[model samples]
Structure formats: C-alpha cells, structure tokens
Target: MTGNPAHRRWLMLAIGTGGQTAMTTVLYGLPSLLPAFQREFGLSLAGAGALVSGPILGILLTMVGWGLVADRRGERFALAAGLLPAAAVLSVAAAVRGATALAVLLVLAGACGASVNSASGRLVIGWFPPHRRGIAMGVRQASQPLGVGLAAAVLPPLAEHAGLPAALGCCALLCAAVGGVVLLLAVDPPRPPETGTVRGPGPYRGGRLWRLHGAAALLCVPQFVVAGFALVFLTTARGWPAATAGTVLAVANLAGAGVRLLAGWWSDRVGSRLRPMRLLALATAAAVLLLALGAAAAPPLGTAALLLATALTVSTNGLHNTAVAEHAGPAWAGRALGVHGLGQHAAIVLVPPLTGALVTAHGFAPAYALAAVFPVAAAALLPGEPAAPAGETAAPSLDAASAAPRTPA
Candidate 1:
C-alpha cells in the first residue's frame, strides 16, 4: 500500500460506480427510447420489445466470460476491454438505420458492458474489509436504480426532440467518458499471495455457494413481478390514473434503492450478510402475500401492499452480492459473482413472460400469490450461519490487507 490507500480505494469505488451507472443506463434505461423506436422504425410492439431486450440477451451470453477475464487478467483490464468496445458499438448503433443492425449493435454493446457487473464487485471485495463490504456493495448495487432513473429522465426527451441517434450518442458518450476515467484511475486491489489459481475449482466444492445462488434466483421472481407489473396492476385493476400510478411506483423505486443501502448497512452491523438477507426474504414473502390479499380485498390496501412488496423485494441484492464475493475469496470472486448474477438474470428474463401469463390466466391476485411463493422458497433455501463452509474462513485472508485502519466512510 502507498500513501492515502483509503483515498485510493474509495476513489476506485467511485470510478467503478460511475462505470456501472453508465452501463446500466444504457442496458436497462434505453427502453425509455422504445416509443421513439416504434415511431421511427414503424416496428411492431414485439419487435420494439426485442430491440430493447437485445442488451440483456448479450449480457447473458457474456457475463461469465467477462468474469473469467477479470479473474485471469485484472478488473481494470476487463473493464477497459468491455467498456471501450461497448462505447464503440453503441456509437455504431447510433449511426445505423436498420432495426436489425441497431439491435445487433446494442447486443454487442451489452455484451461488452457486462464486465462491470462481475469485476466491480470483485474490486470491492479486494479493496474493502468484510465489515465495510456490505454498505460498499449496497452503494454499488444502487447504481441500477440510479441508472434507470437517469435513463427515464433523460432518454425520452432526448429521443423525442433530437432523434434516436442523438439520444444513443449521448449513451455512447457516457460509456466512452467512463471508459476513459477507468483506464486512467482504476487500480486492482492487492491480493494475498496464496489466493489460489485463476482456474481453480473454486468455492463450489461445497453446496453452500450453490444454495446461495438458487436462493438468489428464487428471490428474483418477486422483484421482477413488482418491477414489471405493479404500475399496470394499479392502472388497470385498481382504476388509478396512469400518471398517479407511475408517480407512486417511482417513489417505490426510490424507496427500493434506499432499502438496498439500509440492508447492506444492517448486514455490516450484524456482521453477516446472509442473516439480514434471510430476514429480508421473509419480509418480502410477507409483503407479497399482503399484496395478494389486498388484490383480493381493498384497492387502497393493494396499493400500499404493492409499495411494500416493491421495496422489500430488492433489499437482498447488495447482501447477496457481498456474501457471494466474500464466500468465493479473491481468487474466484469474479467468477462467483458472474454466476450469481447469471442466476438472477435468468429469473429476470423468464419471470415477465411466465408471470404475465399467470396474471392473464388467473389475475393479479394469483400472480402476486405466485410471486410470494418464490420468496418463501428462497427463505427455505437460504443457508444459516451454521451451514457455512469450513473453507469460508480462509477466503477472507485475501482481504487481510484491507483490515488496515483508516477513513470514517
């Protein structure tokens, strides 16, 4: 370590967050441009949906590959390799006219941008002590909502007034700017000498990591249900105006971001990520069940229950991320985080269609009931402290350097 190591690490976290926010804004936020896409290209609703989904499809294909790169090369290298190319592809997408070409370019951009998801978390694991990792990851995880908010605020107007290319160029510029910053300022965290081989079998030697992955995937069901349909539920089923429903859900989204930070802080205070996560899983189940009951009962109760469900469902994200990285250790952290993300993304990808069908067939009450079941399943799947693997103790040695005293943050 050199002079002002704390400053350097926190600086790295900020850089990572910036990079992540840029990618997320493009990946999830670009959907704000969907109406523009439909108008300009005269595409069907399904076609426009596919265009927006291109990035996620690309993300699924490349997440673990990026993780492998980070593990073998370095976080800085992986991020640069990904972000720079992502920016380039997005710039090309901005210039393209054909819908198919634009969709392909967006997919490629997403593939490149996927690097931050795995590597940024690994960066936090390397630089921060276990005690601080929770809140740090919490702040990192909040990038998703923040990016979405940014996209919602900026993209629609940008597309409407200046046209699609201009809006996409803005997204391209963001990635390019962040890529430049990361290349200049980012540093990989110091690692323990014995932190296993890059291609080592990893923490999966035990069933704990697998259980964690499954539980995380299960938890995603409730999250996506609320995220994808809560507004529609309010507008159609409950007779709330579209603007009012959107406003309430926007507030719920903000609250969801706050809960992620709070969950992380609580995990750090309790000295265990899984415990707080388990509790949140229980809380999410209860909230979703309440939502279902409200769906079957009073409109006011249903809206309140919907807000509770939205906030609680997202609370475990930071905790799960921190726990996975800590469990996997420095050597395998990148790969482990990639797999963890893959599980959640799988659920995210599948949930909307499956749950949409459930809603159509049985209504929102049954859909809410179905969503509640996943969290209950997750709670049952979660490993208690006693079930932690014996090898878990050795992993934190990778961050022993981070145990040094320093800043108040």
Candidate 2:
C-alpha cells in the first residue's frame, strides 16, 4: 500500500513489530514448554534449562553475520532470507524424535531468525525521523514481550494437551506467516549519499558503543533469569498449576510490553536515552532483590514482586536499541545493532543454565538475589549522558537525507 509518508512509516513500524513477535515466539516459547519437556523426557532442571539457552546461542553465533548482510545489502532482503530458513527449520524440528536433535534444530533456527534483530532496527532508524524514533522503536521493541506473552498464553496449553510437536509447529507457522508479510510489505529506506572525502573512524571504533554493549549484556541477565524460570518456579516451588502460572507470566509479559513503550516515550521527552536506561537498571536491581525477599517470606508477595521485576527489567531494551541505532547512523546501524544484540543474547545464552543450577541447589531466593547484582553493575557501568553525535545534539538529529524518501536499497 502506498500513501502518506507518515502512514508508510507507521506501516513499516507495524511490520517490524510483527516480524519481531513472530521470531521471538519460539525463543521465548521454549521456557513455557520447558516443564513439559522435562516431564516427557525425564530431564534434570539444568538439562531442560539448556533448551532455553540453545536458541540464544544460535542467535549469538549469527547476529554479526546477519548485521553485516543488512549493512551491505538491505533490511528487507535480510529479514526475508532469515525468516524463511528459520521457519523451515522450526517446522522440521517439530517432528524430531530425540531431545538432542530437537535442541540442535532450535539452535539452528535461532541463528536464522537473528536476521530480524539487526535488520528490523535498521529499518526503524532509516525510516523514522530522530525525534519520533524513540516511541516507534519502543513499539517495535514491544514485539519481544508481546511474543513472550503470546507464548506463555498459548504454548503451555498446546504442549500440555497436544504435545511438544504442536507447540513447536505453531511457532513454525508464525515465522512463515510473518516472513511472507515482511517480504510483501517491507521497503528499505534510501541510503545516505557518501561524501568523496576520506571518512573518519567507524562508529564501532569508539568506547561509547562498547560501553553500551557491556551495560546491555549485564542488564539482560535479570531479564533472562526472570523469564526463564518464573513459570517453573510458580508451578514446582509454589504449588501452582501450570496454567495458572502461565497466565500470571503472560500478564506480566503484557504489562512489560506497555512499560517498554512508556520507557521509549520517556527517553524521547527527556532528550537522553541513557538516563532512563540507567534509572531502569537501578530499579531492576531493587525489584529483583525485593522479589528474592518476597519469595522467602510470602508466595503471593513473591509473585507480585516477580511481575514488577519483569516489567522493570525489560523496560530498558527499546531505549538501549534506539540509542545504539542513532549513534551508529543508518550506514552502520545494522552491524552496530548486531553487535549490541550479540552482547544481550550472549547473556541469555549463559544466564539460564547458571540460574537453573542455582535453583536446583539453593532455591529461587538465591537465584534471584544473584540475578540482582548484574543490573546494579549495569547501572554503575552505564555512561553518563551520552555525547551528542557529531554535528548534532544528544536528542536524535533529523537531517534532510534521512528525512527524504527514496527507493529501497
């Protein structure tokens, strides 16, 4: 559909959000299905926990490659290429017999799906003006929690009744459907014209990006810890039914989605993304500590704390992503975001098993208490108000080239 430029921009945002949701369904869905996998396969908590990290490991391995492809080619091509293969692999994975084979397939599928992370962010930075990008990217970032919410709401029942294959097939179907939609609708923004003069050092050649990456990695530890274990904790430790725990986690994910949007909008209004991100990191630490205390004292209180922690822990992602894109600029946004994503996914890959071991040995209290430390460290590590991009203020700069529409790359 062709229409007002604003309409097209919004449409791109919607498409990007949809693509993210579709891919993340499988990644986040694994957690919801983990209990069922454990029962069916007679697996240990740590062994079952490995499934949660497998896809993230896949994402870590290929994110940079996908980012490079998006930078060299275009966002649309990278997104479609990634989703198609991921969909195919996930479909096959649904039919695999052994847990080992299934885990391998999930990891491979995740590697393919990593394409959406960089390409989608690049699309937002390229299409939206700097002033409005925070909210737009926030809405885009909501796709992650939205996908997790969907998984928590839908996959548990499907896995319980129809079995693992049905749940996995559902993820495959979502990826394929979203991939088709992205292929039809996604259009990359025009590339900025290059000046003939020799360029200075690249965006990645700075300490700022590395600092952001480090903070993102540390902050992600709490998010993954909460997400990976919440349902299982409720079901096994607290004596709640699977469906009840899934519903609670699903509601928390939904609330987290709204918080993500607000965080993005707040960053825009404040003219500094890092400020809000830093604040959220501190809040997440407090929330997790409270959650650990509540877990030991009262189950209901602990559940409330868990919900609050989920929202606080996840609220920073959009702001962090938008800052990375703005700093990288359109030319390097893909690769830069890829690097940013690598740090976060690497944390995801590591956090699950480590947390699971803690849960297996000590209990949820120790696991959550340990998780709190990372976000506090992230808050300390976060750079103060980011330096403005060259020739522009800290508030994202909207120039003529970025504002103008051109043929998709």
The number of the candidate with the highest lDDT is 2
lDDT of prediction 1: 0.79
lDDT of 2 by residue, 84-155 (tens): 899999999989878889889989999999999999888877787766778888999999998988898899
C-alpha lDDT (0 to 100) for residue 188 of candidate 1: 89
| Model 1 agreement with the true structure over 93-162: per-residue lDDT tens digits | 9999999899889889888999989988787667787778888888888777667656655666677678
Backbone clashes in model 2: 0
TM-score of 2: 0.96
Which run of 10 residues does model 2 get worst, by summed lDDT?
400-409
What residue runs in model 2 are displaced by over 4 Å at the alpha carbon?
Answer: 388-393, 397-400, 403-409
Local distance difference test values of all predictions, in order: 0.79, 0.86
Q: Residue 38 of model 2: what lDDT?
A: 89
Tell me the lDDT of model 1 at 409: 43
Judge candidate 2 against the unseen true structure and give its global Cα lDDT, from 0 to 1. Answer: 0.86
Per candidate, the number of residue pairs that clash is: 0, 0
